[model samples]
Target: MRRIVGADAVCALIAGALGYLVRFGPAGTDGQHVSLGVALALPLVWVAAMLVARSYEERFLWVGADEFRRVFFASALLLATVGTVSWAFKLDVARGFVVLALPLATLLTLGQRYAQRQWLHRRRRHGLFRQTTLLVGHRAGVESLHQQLEREAYHGYRVVGCALPGGRDVAAQFDGLPVLGDLDEVVDIVRGFEVDTVAVLPSPELDGPALRRLGWDLEDTRAELLLAPAVTEVAGPRVRIRPVAGLPLLHMERPELTGVRRLTKGAFDRTSAALGILFLAPVLLGIALAVKVTSHGPVFFRQERVGRDGRTFSMLKFRSMVVGADRMVDDLAEESDGNGVLFKKKDDPRVTRVGKVLRRYSLDELPQLINVVRGDMSLVGPRPPLQGEVERYGYDMHRRFLVKPGLTGLWQVSGRSDLSWDDSVRIDVRYVENWSLTFDFMILWKTAGAVLRGSGAY
Candidate 1:
C-alpha cells in the first residue's frame, strides 16, 4: 500500500510534466494559450485510468513487472478514454499533443522510479535513510529477519537490535546486531533507540496479551508495528486482513488455476510467444546456425521437463552441452556447485564455444518460445524443473508444478542457478500463489536486463 502511494505520486508528477511539454513546447510557455485546461485534463485521465485499472493498488509494487504494465495499460486506457470523450463532446483535443504526452510521461515516470530505487539502495548500504527498528521475536527468528533485511538493501531498514520475549541467554550480540535487552524492557528499548518501527517476528511462545499491550504502548509513540510472519516468498496480495468481532483475522487465499483465469493465462502465453518468436526470428536463426556449425551435435536440446499439474513436456532449448550430455550427468555431478536437486556448473567442459555465447545472452532459451506457442510453456512462470527433480519432490515442492513453467521467472531474475533449491522452490511457490499478467510482463522486462548482464547464468 505504501509502495502504491509512493509510485502514484511519482507517476502524477512525471505525467503532469510531460503533459505540459506536449501542450506548450515554447510558444505556450511565452504566454500564448498555455492550455492549462488540457494539462489538467490529462492528469485527470491518467488518474482515472490508474484507479480503474487498479494500477495504484497495493498488490504489485514489490514483485516483477506488474507495476510497469499497469502503468502502460492505464496510460493507454487514459488516452483511449479521453480520446473517445473528446470526439463525443466535440472538444478540441489534439492527437499530436496526446501522442507526444503519453509515451514521454511513461518513460520519464519509469526512469525516475528506477533512479529513486538506486538512490534508496545506496542510502540503505550506508545505513542512512533507514527506519530504526526494534526487532521483537525469538533468537532464530530475529537472526533470520535481520539477515533478510540486510540482504534486501532496497527495503531501507536499520536493525538497532532485538528485544526478545522470554528469550534465553539474552546475548549481547546476535548475528552482529546487538540484543538490546529482554522483553520486559520493550518500552525502554523503543525510547532509548528512538525506534520508529517494531518488527515482531513470530515466536512459538509469544505472549498474546503482551503483544496486544505492545501495540497499545506503541499507539502513544509514533512507532509503526509490523508483524513478520513465518511465511516466506508469499506475496502481500495473498494475505487479507478482516476484523471480525474485534479480532484481526488473517486469511491466505488459495492458488487458483481454472475457469477464466486459465483461459486468460493461456491467451497471454500464446499471444506473447507468437509475437516473441516473430520478433526474434532473425536472431534465432543466426544463433541456430552458429551452434550447428560450431558443435558436432543437434542444434537443439529437447529435454523432458515437469510442467503444470506434473505433466511431462519436451522443453526446447539451443543445445549448450555435448551430444548425449544426459549420459554424463553422474560425471558432472561430481563437479556441481548447484543446489542439491539441480545440476549446474559455472564453467563446464561440455559447453561448445558457440554454446557459451548463447547461454550468456540467454539465446539458448529461444526455442521455449515455440513451447509457449504450443501451450506447453508460458512466457513468464516458474522455471521448469527436470523430470528427475520432479520425481524427488516433497509435499511443498509439488507447488512448483501448479502452473506452466516459463522461459523467465522469479528464479531466473533472482540469482538463477546461484540460488539454492530451497530458495528456488519458495520463489516459485510465491509466483504461483500470486500469479498475474502484469507480473509476467515485469519478469519478462527484468529478464532482458538479467540476460544483458549475464549474471549467474550457469
Candidate 2:
C-alpha cells in the first residue's frame, strides 16, 4: 500500500514537472514562481485525492478493474476540486498545467499500477505473496471454489483448508485439503490457521443473519472475508449490488446483445479491421505470394462458418492446405488431434510447406479482416464455427450466436486448437454472456501474445 502511494506520488510529481516545462517553458518570472508552488503542492493533493477514492485499498489492489476505476475517480475528483477552488478563490491557476498534469498523472499512475499488478501476478504464479485462504461452504461449493482457486493461482489465493456445513463428520478431508470444521467453526479455523482470507461460498446453513454474524466475528481477525456467490462467469460490469428495504440484492443487467453499445462495437470493429488491413497490406501480399507459389490452390480459402443468429457466412483465410484437402476429411478423421468438434492435426499431410509457416503464426487469418469489414465477423468474439460444429452444438452453446463470430476471441487467445470441446464452449459462452468493448480490447491484446507464441495453433 505504501509502495503504491509512493509510486503515485512520484508519477504526480513527474507529470507536474513535465506540465510546467511544456506550458511555461524555461522562463524565470513571477508566473514561474507560482507554477513551482502549485507543482510542489500537486503531488500531496493528488495522493490525498487517491486516498479519498480508496485507490490504495488492499481489496482493490492487484486484482480486477476496480483499482483502475478508483484511480480514475481520484483523477476526476482532483480536477473538480482544483477547478472549484481556483474559481472560488480567484486563484491564477494555469489551465494548461492542470489539464496536462492531471491527465498525464492519471495515465502514469495507471501504467505503474498495471506494472505492479503484473509483477504481483508473476510472483503469485511462483507461489509467492499468496494469501492463505480458508473456504467455508457446503461440500460441493467448497470443492468448486478450491478447484477454481487452484486453477487461477495467479489470483494469489492459497486454499489451506475448508470448513463445510457438517464439518469433520461429513468427511475427513475435502478436495485434498484438510476439513477444518463446520460452517460455525469458520472464525475459529481462520484464527487457528492464521488464514489471510476467508472465502464463504453460498450454503443453506448460512443465512443473512448468520453471514452477518460471521462478518462481524471476522472483524477482529486479520483475515478478510470474501463472499463467493453462486453466480459464476459473469463480469463485474454486468452485476450490481442494489440495497432495497435493507436487503442487498444482486442485480444482473441483461447482456447487451442489441443496443447502442453493440452498434459502437460494430463501428469499432469495422474501423479497426479496415485500418489493420491497410497497415498489413504488405504482409498480406507476401503471404498471398507464398501460398500461391507453394500450393496449387486459391490464395484464399473460403469456408462456410456459423455467425450471429446461426447465419452462415463465407469466412476467409489464406490457403493453408492442399487443393483437395477437404475431400480427404473422412479418410483423415481417424488420425485427428483436435477437440472432437474441431478437426486439427499437428502434422497433417494436407498442409503445404508454406502453409505450415502460415498456420504457426496465424498469418492465415489475416484475410478475416475483410470478413470484419463486411460485418460478417468481429475483431473479438466467439470463434466462428464450422456448420458441422454448429449442428452438434448443445442448446446452451447456441447463445454464442448472440454476437457475430470473431477473427480472434476467448477461444483463440485461450488455447485455440488445444482447448477441449467443453473448455471451448465454456470460454465462448462466457464471452457471449459478458460482452463489452473493454472485454474485447483485453481479448485483442491477449490475442497478440497468443499469436506470437503460437502455443495452441496447429
Candidate 3:
C-alpha cells in the first residue's frame, strides 16, 4: 500500500510536468506561463483527491476493475474541482492542461499499479506474500474451500492447514493440505503454524457464539477470521450484507438487463460497430480479398446462431474453412476434442494456411462487427451458441439468452476454444448475471491482451 501510494504521487508529479511542458514548454520571459504554479500544486492535490476517494483502500487494490474505476472517477472529480475553482476565481486555467494531465496521471497510476500487481502475483504464484490460511469446517466444506483457493492463487490465500470438527483420527493430509488439528484446538493450531487467517467455512460447529469466542481468542494473535459463504460467481456489487435482528442476511439485487440500460447498450453496440467499420473499412476489405484469394469458399461465412430470448440470428464471420466444412463435422467427430458441446479443433485439417493465420489472431471474427451493427449481436456478451449447442443447454444455461449474443465475450478472452463446457458456461452465466457497462469495458480491455497472446485462440 505504501509503495502504491508513493508511485501514484510520483506519477502525478510526472503527469503534471508533462502536461505543462506539452502545452506551454516553459514559463515565458515575463514569467507568464501557468505550469510553474500548476505543476507544483497538481501532484499534491491529486494525492489528496485519491486519499479522500478511498482509491487506495485494500479491498479496491490489485484486482478487478474497482481500482481502475475509482482512479478514473477520482481524476474526473479532480478535474471538476479544478474547473469550479478556476471559474469561481476567474483565473485562466488551461483546458488543455487539465485534459492532458488528468488522463496522463490516471494512465500512469494504473500502469504502475498493474506493474506492482504483476510483481506481487509472480511472488504469490511461488507462495510468497500470501496469507498462510488455516481451514476450519466440516470435511466437505473445507475441501471445497481449499479447491477454490488453490485454483485462484491471485487471492493471496495459501491454505497451510485444516481443522475438521468432531472427525475421527485422520491421516496427516486433509485434501492435500496438512491437518493441523481439530476444531477444538483451532486457536492453538493457528498460533502454532503462525497462520495469517482462520478461514471458517459454513458448518454447524461454528455457530454465532463459537465464532464470537473464536474471534476473542484471536485477539491476541495475528490471525484474522474470514467466513467463506457458499455463494458462487456472484460479484461484490450484487451482494450486500444486511444485519436484520442480529442475523447477517445476504441481500442480492436482481440484475437489471432491460429498459433504458438495454436500449443504451444496443445504441453503444451499433455506434461502436459502425465507427469501427468506418475506420477499419480498408483492413476489412483487405481481409475479404485475402480470404477470397486463399480459399475456394466464399469470403463471408454466415451461420444461424441462437440470440437473446431464443431468437435466431445470422451470425457473420470471415470464412475460415472449406465450403462444406459443416458436412465435414461427421468425419471429424471421431477426432473431436472440443468441450463436448461446441465443435472446435485446435489443429483441424480443414483450415487453410491463410485461415489458420486469421483464426490464430482472431481476425476472422472481424465480420461480426456487421452483426453488431445489424442488432444481431453485441460488442460484448456471451458467445452465440449454435442451434445444436442451444438444444443441449440446461435450464441454468438459458440465462445467457437474456441479453444478445456478443461478438467478443468472457468465453472468447478467458480460454476460447481451450475452455471446457462447464467453464464456458460458468463464465457466460456470470457475465449474464453481472452485466454492466463497466464490466463490458473491462472485458473489452482484457480482449486486447487475449488477442495478442492468442493462448486459447484456435
Candidate 4:
C-alpha cells in the first residue's frame, strides 16, 4: 500500500510538471508564477482525491476493474472540485492547465498501477504474497470454490484448509487440504491457522442469522470474510445489491441483445472488420498464394457454421487442408484428438505442408474478417460451430446462439482446440450471459497473445 502511494505520488508530480511546462513555457510572466503554484499543489490534491475515493482500499487492489474505476472516479472528483471552486470564486484558472494536468496524472497513475499489478501477478504465480484462505461450507461447494481459486492464483488466494458441515467424520482431508473442523469451529480454525480470508460457500447450515453471527465472531480476527453465492459466471456490472426493507437482494440486469448497444456493436464489428481486411490485404494475398501453390485445391475453404439463433452461414478460411478433406472424417474419427464435440487432430493427415504453418500462427482464420463485414459473425464471440456439432447441443448450450459466432472468442483466447467440450461451452455461455463492449475489447486484446503463442492450434 505504501509502495502504491509512493508510486502514485511520483506519477502525479511528473504529470504536474509536464502539464505546467507544456501549458506555460519557461518564461517569467505573471501567469508563470501562478502556474508554478498550481503545479506544486496538484500532487497533494490528487492524492487526497484518491484517498477520498477509497482507491487504496485492499479489496479493490491487485485484481478486478474496481481499482481502475475508483481511480477514474477520483480524477473526475478532482476535476469537478476544481471547476466548482473556479466558477464560484471567479478565479482565473487556466483551462489548459486543468485539462493537461488531471488527465495526464490519471493516465500516469493508471499506468503505474498496471505495472505494479503485473509485478504482483508474477510474484503470485510463484506462490508469493497470497492470502491464506479457509473454506467453510459443504464438501461440494468447498471443492468447487477451491478449484476456482486454484485456477486463478493471481487473485492471491491460497486455500490452506477447510471447515465442512461435519468435522473429521465427513472426511479427514479434502483434495489434499486438511479438514480443519466443522462449521461451528470455523472461528477457532481461522485463528489457529492464521487465515487471512474465510470463504463461506453457500450452505443450508449457514443461514442469514448464522452467517451474521459468524461475522460478529470474526470481528476481532484479522481474517476477511467472503461469501460465495450460488450464482456463477455473472460479471460484476450486471449484478448489483439492492437493500429493500433492510434485506439485501441481488439484482441482475438482462443481457443486452436488442438495443442501442447491439446496434453499436454491429457497427463496430463491420467497420473494424473492413479496416482490418484493408490493412491485412497483403498478408491475406500472400497466404492465398502459398495455399494455392502448395495444394491441389482452391485457396479458400468455406464451411457451413451455425451462427446467431441457429442460422447457418458459410464461414470462410484460407484452405488449411487438402481438397475433399471433409469426406475423410469417418476414416479419421477413431484417431481424433479433439474434445468429443469438436474434431481436432494435432497431426492430421489431411493438413497440407503449408497448412501447418498457416494454422500455427492462425493465419488461416484471417478471411473471417470478411464474415464479420458481412454481419454473419462478430470480431469477438462464441466459436462458430459445425452443423453436426449443433445437432448434439444440450438445451443450455443453445444459449451461445444468442449472439453471432465470432472470428475469435473466449474459446479462441483460452485454449482454442485444446479446451474440453464442457469448458468451451461454459466459456461461450458465460460470455453470452455477460456481453459487453468492454468484455469484447478484453477478449480481442488477449487474442493477439493467444494467436502468437499458437499453443492450442491444430
Candidate 5:
C-alpha cells in the first residue's frame, strides 16, 4: 500500500507535469488541451500536501484516514489554486473539467494508498520485510530505545537489544534483552545482532570526534546509521540538520509564536470553540439542566487548577459528580487502580445519571474552551493535576508546570483516567520537555479521534 501511494503520487506528478508540457507546447501542437498552468497544478499540490501531511513517514503504507485526508486536502488545494489562477489570468479553463479531475485524482490516490497499506500489512505479517536495528548509545539511552521498540511492535523495527560503550558487565537482561555491546564494540555488535541499521542514542555529553567517528565506522558495515537526536516529540518540519566541514550540526528552529502562527492558532481556538459551542450548545444546555435538576449541586463544576506558569484558574466542566466530590479524595484513596497518591474509583456512587455520557465522550470538557479564550488554559497541553497530586509529585514531575494545563493533553490522549500517577507525570513532563505548536496540533488532532472512541474515559 505504501509503495502504491508513493508510486501514484509520483505518477500523478509525471502525468500532470507531462500534461502541462503537452498542452502548452508550441502553437497547435496538441489540440484543445488543458492549459499548461492548470495541468501543472495537480502534481504540485500533491507534493506540497504530502510533505505537509508527512505521508512519507514510512515507505510501506496502509489504509488509514490520515492517508485519505492528506490526498483530499492536497487535491482541494490544487484545484482551488487552479480556480484562483484561472480567474486572475482570465484563462478559458473549463470549470467542469477542473471539477471532474478533483474527485477522480482524489479517489485514485486514496485507492493506491489503501492498496499499498494492505500489501505492507501482509508483508510484515510474513516477516518478509522487517527492520532490524542496532541500538548504539549509553545504557540508559539504549534501555529507553529497547522499551520503545517493544512498545511500538507494529512499526516493524525489531531490536536485537543495544550496543553500549563496552562489552563489559551489561546486565543479563536490560529490558528483557542482553546488552549486545558498547560504542567501541559497535561493528562487532552490529554483526552479532544481525542488524541492518544502527540507531545512535549516545550519551548527552558525547564529544564531536566520537560522534563523527561512530558515523564513519558505520560506513563499512553496510548498515544504516540513524542519529536518534535527544530531541523527541518535536515535529520534523521544525527540525533542520546542517553539516559543517567534517561536522554535522543539528539546528532545531524555535517554534514560532508570533505573527501569523499566533494569529492562526488564536483564530483556530476562537472559531473552533465558537462553532463547537454552537453545535454542542443543546447538549451542553441539556447536561447543565440535568446537573441542576438531578443533583443538589451547581450546574458547572469549577475547580481551581494550576494553569500555565503555575498560575491558578478555575477550570470548568459539566458537574458530573456531587458538588463536594473533592472532599471525598482522602476516603477514596484506597480505591485507586495503582498508586496511592492519585485517587480514582472504577465505579463511584457519586456520579449523576447524565454524567456518564458526558464524561465518556469528554463532552464535559467542552466548557474549557472558554478557559482557552480567556487565557487560563490551552486547548491542548499537560493535564492540570490537583494540588494534592502536585504535592505528591517527585522533582522530575514538576517540569509540567513550565506550561499551562491543557483541556486535552498527552495524558488525556494516551490514557486519561486510567493512567497512574507516575505515568501521568511522565506524559506531562514529556509534553513540557518537547512542546511545539506542531506537536500541540498533532495532539489536538489525535484528541478528536480519541474522544470519539472514548478510550479509557471514565
Candidate 6:
C-alpha cells in the first residue's frame, strides 16, 4: 500500500511540475497567481482524491481491472474539483495546466501501477503473497476447487490440503492436495498447516447450519472463510449478491445488448475504425502493394462471415492466400490441424510466400477496418467466423452473434488459429456476455502483445 501510494504521489507530482512548466514557461514568480504553490497543491489534492476513492485498498490492488478503474475515476474527480475551485474563486488558473496535468497523471500513474503489477505477478508466480488454503468438500468438489486455484495463481490461493466429509476419505487424496482429515478435523488441518484461508465447496454432508458453525469455529483464528461456487467463467461485474430475507442469493445480470450501451459501442467502433484507416493509410497502402506485387491474386480478399444477428457480411482482408484458395479447401480437408469447426492448416500450401509473413503478424486483417466502418464488424468483439463455421453452430453457439464480429477479439488475442473449438467458443461467448467499452479497450491493449508474439497466428 505504501509503495502504491508513493508511486501515485510521485507520478502526480511529476505531472503537476510538467504541466506548470508548459503553462508558465519556468517563470520565477513563486508568490504570484498561478505559481509554484498551485503546482504543489495539485499533487496533494490528487493524492487525497485517490485516498478518498480507496484506490489503495488491499483487496482491489492485487487483482482485476477495478483497481485501475478506481484510479481513473479518482483522477477525474481531482480534475473536477480543481475546475470547480478555479471557477468558484475566479482564480486565474490556466486551462492548459489542468488539461495537461490530468491526462499526464493518469498515463504516468497507470504505467507505474502496471510496472508494480508485473513485479507482483512475478513474486506471486514464486508463491509469494499466496494463502495456504485448506479446502473442505467432497473428493470431487475438493479436486475441482483445487484445479481452479492451481490454474489461476493470480487469485492468490494455494491449496495445501483437503478435508473430506465424515472422515470417509481421510486417507485418500485428490490431485496433490492430500485428504489431510475429515470435515470434523477441518480446524485441526487449518492449525496444522497454518492455513490462512479455509475454502468451502458444496458437499452433501455440509449444509447451511454446518457451514455457519464452521465459520464460527474459525472466528477465533486468523483464517478466512471462502465459499467456492460451482459456477465458472462468470466475471465479477456480472455477479451480484443480495441478502433476501436470511438467504444470500447470487444474481447475474443479463449482458446489456441493447439501449444506449449498444449504441455507444457502435459509435466507438465506427469512429475508431475510421481514425485507424486514416492513421494507417501509409502502412495499409504499402501492404496492398506488397500483396499485389508478390502474389497472383488481387490485393484484397473478401470472404462471407457471420456477424451480429447471424447476418452475413463480406469481411475484407489483405489477400494472403493463392487465387481460388477456397477451391483447395476440400482437397486439404484431411490435412487440417484446426479446431473441429474451423478449417486451419498451419502449413497450408495455398498461403503465398508474402502471405505467410502477413498472416503471422496479422497484417492481413488490417483491411477489416473497412468492415468495422461499414457496421458489419467491430474493433473488438468475437472473431469474424466463416459462413461454414456458423453452419456447424449448435443451438447455444448462436449467442456469439449477439454482437458484431471483430478484426481482433478475445479469440484473436487469446490464441487465434491455435485455439481449440471449445476454447474459442468459451472466450467469444465470455466476451459477448461481458461486453463493455472498458473490457473492449483491455482486449485491444492485449491484442498488441498477442500480435507481436505471433505464437498462435497462422
Q: Candidate 4 lDDT, tens digit per residue, 1-458?
A: 99999888888899888888788776634845666777898888888999999999998999888999999999999999999998998777778988999999999999999999989998998899999999999888888888878867999999999998778888889987899999999999988989999999988999999999999999999999999878888888899999989999898889888899999999999999999999999999999999988889899999999999899999999999999999999999999999987888999999999999999999999999999999999999999999999999999899999999999999888888888887887889899999999999989988998999998999
TM-score of model 1 (CA atoms): 0.80
**Number of the top-ranking candidate, with lDDT as the measure:** 4
Give the Å error, residue 261, model 1.
1.8
- In model 5, what lDDT does residue 359 have? 86
Deviation from native of the Cα of residue 6 in model 6, angstroms: 2.2
Ten residues in sequence with the least summed lDDT for candidate 4: 26-35
lDDT of 1 by residue, 1-458 (tens): 45544555556656665666656664455432434466655555656677787766644543345776787888788778768977898776566666777777677656755665567667778878778888887877888888778767567778888887654355668788888888777777888888989888777555678788888988988788888867766676677898989988887776666778778989978987899889989998998888888879888899898898889999999998889878888988988988988888888888888888888888899899999999999888888988888788788878778789988898888889888776787788878877877667678888888889988886
Off by over 4 Å in 3: 19-38, 41-45, 72-103, 167-171
- Candidate 5 per-residue lDDT, tens place, 1-458, comes to 34554676665665554444444444534434545455556665666666666665543145335556666677777777778987998877766556655566666677666666667656765665668887777777877777666544545677776765554575655666667765678778776666788888847545677867877877877678777878665655557778978666778877554477656666666677777778878877887787789878788888888766667889898889977888886787777664566666767776777888788898888888788777677777788867766777788777777666788888777878777665676677777766666677778878987899898887
Model 6 segments more than 4 A misplaced: 19-27, 30-48, 76-103, 122-129, 138-151, 166-171, 175-177, 327-336, 391-395
Q: In model 2, which regions exceed 4 Å deviation?
A: 329-335
Cα lDDT computed for each candidate against the true fold: 0.78, 0.90, 0.87, 0.91, 0.70, 0.85
Candidate 1 vs candidate 3, TM-score winner: 3
Q: Give the number of the best model, judged by TM-score.
A: 4
Clashes of each: 1, 0, 0, 0, 14, 0
lDDT of 2 by residue, 305-422 (tens): 9999889999999999998898899999999999887898999999989988889999999999999999999999998988888889999899999899999999888788898887
Expressed as tens digits, the lDDT of each residue in 1-458 for candidate 6 is: 88888888899899989988887778644434664667787667778988898988877887789888998999888888878987999887778878998899999999999999988877887899888898888878877677667656867887778888666444666677677888888888887889999988877677888888999999988899988776656788989998999789898888888999889989999999999999999999999999999878799998888889988989898999999999999999989999877888998899999999999999999999999999999999888888888888886578889888888888877778888787787788889888888889899999999999998888
TM-score of every candidate: 0.80, 0.93, 0.88, 0.95, 0.74, 0.84
Task: Please rank every candidate by TM-score, starting with the best.
Answer: 4, 2, 3, 6, 1, 5
Candidates 1 and 5 compared: the better one by TM-score is 1
- Location of the lowest summed lDDT over 10 successive residues in candidate 5: 57-66
